[model samples]
Target: MPSTDDLGSVVDAAVRARLDDSGQACDAAERFIVADDLYDGFVEKFTAALLDRRSGAPLSSVAAAGTLARQVAAAVAAGATLHTEGERRGAHFPAGVLTGLTTEHATARQELSGPAAMVFRAAGEADALRIANDTPYALGWYVFTTDSARAGRVAGGIEAGMAFVNGVGAEDAELPFGGVKRSGSGREPGRPGIEEFVGKKLVRTVA
Candidate 1:
């Protein structure tokens, strides 16, 4: 099991990396732009929830929202890519202590709740699209995507060197695995895995 400190580092690293890849600059235009204040609020809240989950520190709705916003702002300043599924018409979150924070962006027609929905709505299309294209973190260090085009892009992405799109969940003895950028370097498994346990020797015959 990973330690809390290790997990925190992982979460922070992932968050920072995503923010950097978001491609959104922290200029006055972006900072003061009130066009999507509600959506922005939602994004901040959702980000906080995820961070809290990773850190084992459950944050209150209000606290999460504030933390999320601060984190996003910091991420934007540092350049991180945000990802979402886009908005849906009929989404709702369960009522709880965080209900206020949950439905803060509820419009008269649409009552937005759930973290996923909030993220989608807040990120909008452009940032969401950027995330879909740039997010390198996948399930268990494996790249996850159903789009071939996006898969190709991720394969060549500055952050991901090897991406497996819709692959099986088994590790093969003959296969290799590795990553690029912050993910890590070098390969493992199959011959590579064995090589790590042995020394390489080249033999020649002299006549």
Candidate 2:
């Protein structure tokens, strides 16, 4: 993960994709696992970018906002550092970032269905992959690295259904959209996805 050539692009893409749909998308990135070499700088820049672009947009519902608020509080209570804007107001959930989270924390495994992200400092590529795959849910994963071989290796190692490398907005009807583990059981688009909702019955007519 430390092979990143452009932190600016990584930060930009991460912010846009994560905040898209008010950070409520099932595939939105909720956890950021940065290599120890680039963890602090990435966090500083990513947080600043998040705060700058955050629109204070209301979530899908008041209850949704309340749920996110509670999740953030629980993460903090679990010993994760929080950087957020004030507090929740109605359905508006402030974008925030949680740091100092280890794989042992319950918040590390839970999904934040709002404009909040958790960042973990990884020892290196192996640790980064470990952290990325630590959760039970594995819908989507993003990798930013300049090394082509490392990129391919990391992409293959990620435990998600879809792995986007060095970019975002890869979702399309042509691509199989789904996740492994607790995220879901089947695909929803592309070739394989078409079979997820269809039932087949054998009909034989003797001629």
Candidate 2 matches the true fold with a TM-score of: 0.93
Clashes of each: 11, 0
> By how many angstroms RMSD does model 1 differ from the true structure?
15.5
Reference-based TM-score of each model:
0.32, 0.93
Model 2 lDDT tens row, 149-177: 98899999999889988888888988898
Highest TM-score model number = 2
TM-score, structure 1 vs. true: 0.32
lDDT of 2 at 132: 89
**lDDT values for all models:** 0.33, 0.88
Residue pairs with clashing backbones, model 2: none
Question: Residue-wise lDDT of candidate 1 within 83-162, one digit each (tens)?
Answer: 43222222211211111121122221121112311122213324433432343332122233335665455445424334
Q: For model 2, give the 10-residue run with minimal summed lDDT.
A: 1-10
